[model samples]
Target: MIVSNVSLSGCAGANSALCAAVGDGHQGGGSYRSTLSPTGNLVVAVCLGFIGTFGLLNNLLVLILFCRYKMLRSPINLLLINISISDLLVCVLGTPFSFAASTQGRWLIGEGGCMWYGFANSLFGIVSLISLAVLSYERYSTMVVPTEADASNYRRISQGILLSWLYSLAWTLPPLFGWSKYGPEGPGTTCSVDWTAKTANSISYIICLFLFCLITPFLVIVFCYGKLLCAIRQRKYRKFLAALQYVFGLTE
Candidate 1:
């Protein structure tokens, strides 16, 4: 069946699926298939519907603010705006259809749509993750290193943002080239990587994607925040010592 959707760049011609049940709490998944009955599905639909609507409005407003106000156009704000863009994509593209499918207890977007929705869902999710890691590293660098604190690193940050999208494209595009594949999963209510397929190509893609995409970004986030925490502790210790020195000097 033909699926109608606004064309986007990554994996437009590819078939795919959304996050598995294990990944995003979506109905279709590995061992965690959707067990929701009609009534339960209705409840889920209500919750997801509300979240999608509210998030879309909020993220869209932030994006507009960034564009409307020059003062808001800082380097860090650029990263944040990108984050908002990714979230808004999820809201507008992934949420409604998935929720509707859940409610109906089947995939409604047709075969091609299953691929489109899944492709979109994966793309947005990776963008969000990488943006967050980049945002945290940016914050840490600005706070810890005084010299590189200004928007002088704007070029680098922009490059990083570009790289984030590129990285997402790198992983998502493989299925189209036959390195891996995407299809319906978990009770046929959702779509995602065919995790059940244990072909060598699929396994390799999964391993590489997990390492470069998931694990790498996660480590960057943790390392940046970890350093930031130590810096905070040291700053507090110095302040405490300075206060004691001032009091002792007065007594002397």
Candidate 2:
């Protein structure tokens, strides 16, 4: 958990008291001292290890299934593959570093690693979210306009896959350019977008990230799924009405 009292800026290594109070002398910079005791850190490490292991295995299985089974390579399934790829990337590139940091009770990697971690995770995460949103829309489209869901639909799915990555790239790149910054977050073991920074730059980026990357995709998913449910209900209702009419006509 991130404590409000912790500063975004870390003290230099030369300052003994400052360094001790903050946390460890990470090559990247200093970070907040974790409120969690050694036991808590150990628990975190264990959890991360478990999650990382399973995540790697599961996502790898998904990729293998997709590749091995040509029948599973439908347009809609492409989105699933995209999601698995992003998740697998997160497991490979992001999870192990945080796991290591948790084990050491601090971010062992330098500042560059922290920034890279924050960026990579953010990129993969946003891609997954956007891909989900696109998948929802694709389902809705397939139902509402079955004619368009033909072999030609692969182009649309391909575009969606490409756009998800592009959209994620657009959002995650801002921090590297100075719109916001990435740094050590909760417990000083994991790095992420600097949620603690109160500056206009940081706050603005956070707001945009929440609005576009999170809220927009969420709304898309809800709208698509809601329409799908309505369509299904309507189709069922029509079938029921048809059956009733047929029975009445026969009785008459």
Best lDDT among the predictions, by candidate number: 2
Ten contiguous residues with the weakest lDDT in model 2: 13-22
Put down candidate 2 lDDT per residue, 1-252, tens digits, no spaces: 222355536545323323432444432244434446799989999999999999999999999999999889888999999999999999999999988877777676666787899999999999999999999999998899886356678889999999999999999999998888887776677778988777899999999999999999999999999999999999999999889989889434
Per-residue error for 220 in candidate 2, Å, reads 0.4
lDDT of each: 0.75, 0.83
lDDT of 1: 0.75
Per-candidate TM equals: 0.80, 0.88
- Model 2 reaches what TM-score against the true structure? 0.88
What overall lDDT, based on C-alpha atoms, would model 2 receive against the true structure? Answer: 0.83
By summed lDDT, the worst window of 10 consecutive residues in model 1 runs over 23-32
Clashing pairs in 1: 16-115, 17-118, 17-191, 17-192, 18-191, 21-29, 28-186, 29-186
